[model samples]
Target: MEAVLPVEVEIPSMRVLAESKLKEAEWVKQCYEQLNFIDEKRLTALCHGQCYQQRMARTFNKKGRPREFSPGDLVLRKVLHIAPDSRGKFAYKYDGPFIIQEVFDGEAIILNDMDGNDDALPVNADALKKYYP
Candidate 1:
């Protein structure tokens, strides 16, 4: 069997080479401009997101009243989840006439039972409401 040799490719002229180089430079410039445009778009999106978050926070905070509790205050602890063995909808929502033993920063509090036994962990102030006699 005889093997066929590949044909030689023609070299481009100087004029063609110069034209191709100009096109390449133009393409590079276009790519750089696109990159800059994308960066500007990303920065604008980030700023808009931050502004949206600030607006939402401001609106929410305007409607909210801060809960403040001090030591020796009687409060009721909200029951989170009902036991499976107990009554479902009929179960009591609030648990305690617990006394506020200690108050911490950020609305965290320690509670004491009626017998004066301190709770093991601190609870959020939102979970407790003032109990009146």
Candidate 2:
């Protein structure tokens, strides 16, 4: 008769298991630290972007002069486009020697034609300059 041999299974030692668990914990801690760093960097970048936008706006605004107009002022309106069919390139850039009939807050003005007829719509002072006739 042949004798049967029993098989033995190998198991990791407790020290090895403990070391692996410690390594996993350390890796998780490092990942959390990296996530925190990324979040802080994003927040800092957002603040910097906002500050840059505000600074640019301030600088641009500094270069612009406010247009002021009062009733009875003579002003010329900027001609954006004349009838396309007439005087294509030779058309004057500004149209009116219109009179300011009424002035409203925030640079809004009502204009009157030379014949003393009020314009149908209010015009922005920015679009009109002192005619200096």
- Tens digits of per-residue lDDT, candidate 2, 15-123, equal 4435456577765675577677888889999999999999999999999987778788899998866886768788788988999999988878899998998899998
Q: Per-residue lDDT of 15-84 in model 1, one digit per residue for the tens?
A: 4445556577765675577677888889999999999999999999999998789899999999988888
Q: For model 1, state the Cα shift of residue 11 in Å.
A: 36
The Cα error of candidate 2 at residue 61, in Å, is 2.0
- lDDT on C-alpha atoms for all candidate structures: 0.83, 0.79
Clash-forming residue pairs, model 1: none
Candidate closest to the true structure, highest lDDT: 1
Q: Given candidate 2, what's the lDDT at residue 23?
A: 72
Residue pairs in collision within model 2: none
Judge candidate 1 against the unseen true structure and give its global Cα lDDT, from 0 to 1.
0.83
In candidate 1, where is summed lDDT lowest over 10 consecutive residues? 1-10
